[model samples]
Target: MGYLKNIAIAVLALSLFTFVVLFGQLPALRKTPLGTLQRALCLHLPNGLRSVDSRVTGGNITSKSRRLGQYLFYEQNPVVLILFLFLLTGSAALFLWNALHRLPMSLIVPLPIVLIPPYWFTYLCATDTDHYITPANHQDRLRDYPYDHVLFRPGAICKTCNLVKPARSKHCSLCGHCVAKCDHHCPWVNNCLGRGNYSFFLALLLTLGVLQLYGAYLSYWILKPYLVTDATRSLPWREYLPELGDAMVEAVNMGGLSIAGVGLLAASTAALPLGLFAYHCYLIWAGMTTNETQKWADWRDDIADGGVFKTSREALLSHSRPRSPEGANGAASTGLAVHLGVTEEEPQVRWPISSAQVIVRTNDGRPPRGQETLWTQIWSLSDVDNLYDLGGWDNLMEVLNGR
Candidate 1:
């Protein structure tokens, strides 16, 4: 009973941490109560502690911890990847050691099939470098996706990589390279999930969910007798509640942590990967990436501020490209900060849909200088076209094909 109580408490704590860590950065969730808590934990709390440390210890404590924090979190490291694999392997080993012998051959036969894919896919996701944009492949990366004229534009250059920021590409500071078709950097794999390995990341999520569910099932198989009672459906609600509680306690006492605890852990946490997979699926359907969603969210917020202007690409192309954005330093009036390339030209790309819509963010929440007639103020995301979305099926193929 004490062991069960401890396990419950541990899982509850872990669930909260996982919720904050995984869902904190999502644009939709950032304004929720969870988001507020996340900011307090990841931002305000750390700053307050660091400030106190600086006063008490002449910044010595925080200075050292900050460097360690930078290395562990801000830099590209295998700490998270190792921890994920270690936990995954340890949980499976613990569950199998206790429950495998009790499982039937029918159930035992599928274990290898279910178990091997997560490891294989994780290897693929972690090691893939084909998505990394280099001078040798810069032109090729550029031709993969056409600039949507809304979210992505030509002429933006990454100061670090000194490479033209390709449509749908993003520079990952941790990886120290621009990634083509960049979604988001995933610490769980210690790599950027982009063109080359995004499909494998999806596979890893799927196999991981399946593996957890199957492990939980095997544990259930071993503890089924203790988990059930002769109490009938005719039992009152109060009686049934007590019966169910008693049955679960008996099951835990019989199976201990290996069977009951791992089972509960696996069953409860299976939603994490599956829910993430579903979110990714929705992104594909909408023709966006995790990185792009953040960008689009900023645009939406700016539009709400009446700071976003739309025009035809032809109208903008008619005028000479400016060496720099007119109000580069002044784009702070809008709630969002816009990054526009200085004196960039649109590159020719092979794509089914070519968009002519162009959008610009102004520092004054007004139209660009001497171009009032050519611009139209916009207020909604539906007005924007996502050229990357070729419908859900095509988007999935694009990911699978690594394009």
Candidate 2:
């Protein structure tokens, strides 16, 4: 009973912590209680801790502690990756060792085989070095995608890299380099998922999810006979809470506790990767990256607040030209342009689809009023074209091909 209680407490606590860490900062949940709790945990709690530490150590400990926290959480480190691998390997090893003699040949053959792909793909993604954009290849990288003028615009340069920022590229502070078509940096893989490694990352997620579900199923299979043999003593299924306690006890008596625990862990954690994979699939279908989706969500909020306005893409493109005579530059040349009184540049890369509208934001809530035909008020995102979207099938191909 004590062991069961301890395990349950530990699992619940870990699940809660993971939930807060994962979904706390999501834009969709920003206004919800979960978001507020996340802010409190991430921001307010840290500040409070720092304040207490400052008082305790006369300000000696605050900065160091903050740096440690940043390095552990925000920066690239192998701690989480090591922990993930340890958990995966440890659980699988323990389960297989315990069940080796009892398990059938068919189950034994495929169990280890299922793990191979995720490990291989994870290694490939972690070691793949093709995503980084350097000064030597920055010119060629610019041709990968065109700026949509909403989330990404031409003429912007990365100050750190001192190169023209390509559409969908972002400078990863941890990597200290710009990655093309940057997805979020994943600490679990200890790698940045970008244009080069995104397919492998997806494959890793899918395979890992399968591995976890398989682990859970095997665990259940091993425990089922034991559970059935003790049916007279087993509590009713309708009373799940009490029945769970009885089940745990039966598992321990049958020498299946470790396997049962692994199943619980697998079942609990499997949802995370499967959910993430589904969300990424949605992003691929929508022709967006995680970064771009966040930007679009922000734009949607701004539009709702009446801070966003739009103009015809053709009207803006007419005044802008390629930045260089060589036609290699996508940035707009220095010249007065009508939209927002800022010079706009034509996209260097010829995108598959063209933007129907150019969207801009004003600091004040007032809409931009001018040539009514050119500058029209956009009420929603549907009013503008998603230049990245070439339909779901093509977008999936683009991600898979790493273009």
Best by lDDT: 1
Q: After superposition, how far is residue 253 of candidate 1 from its true place, in Å?
A: 1.7
lDDT tens readout by residue for model 2, 1-403: 6777887789888877778777877777788998888999889997888888889997778888768869876898988888888988888888878877877888889976787887898789888868889988888889888777788877777999998899889999887789999988888888788989999999999999999999888887788766554454565666655666666677756755468877888887897888789978998999989888888888988888887778665555443445433322223311324333334446457567666566878777654433334456679889877888999999999988876
- What TM-score does model 2 achieve against the real structure? 0.85
**Where's the lowest-lDDT run of ten residues in candidate 1?**
329-338
Where model 1 places Cα greater than 4 Å from the true spot, the runs are 1-13, 55-61, 231-235, 319-345
lDDT of 1 by residue, 1-403 (tens): 4555677688888888888877886888888998888888889998999889989998999989989878777899999999999999998898888787788899989989999999999999999999999999998888888877677867789999998899989999999999998998888999999988999999999999999998888888888887666772467878886676677788888988899889998988998998789988889888899899999889988988889888775555444333335333233322122233322355668777777787888889988766676679988988888888899898878877876
* lDDT values, one for every candidate: 0.82, 0.77
lDDT of 2: 0.77
Task: Return the TM-score for each candidate structure.
Answer: 0.88, 0.85
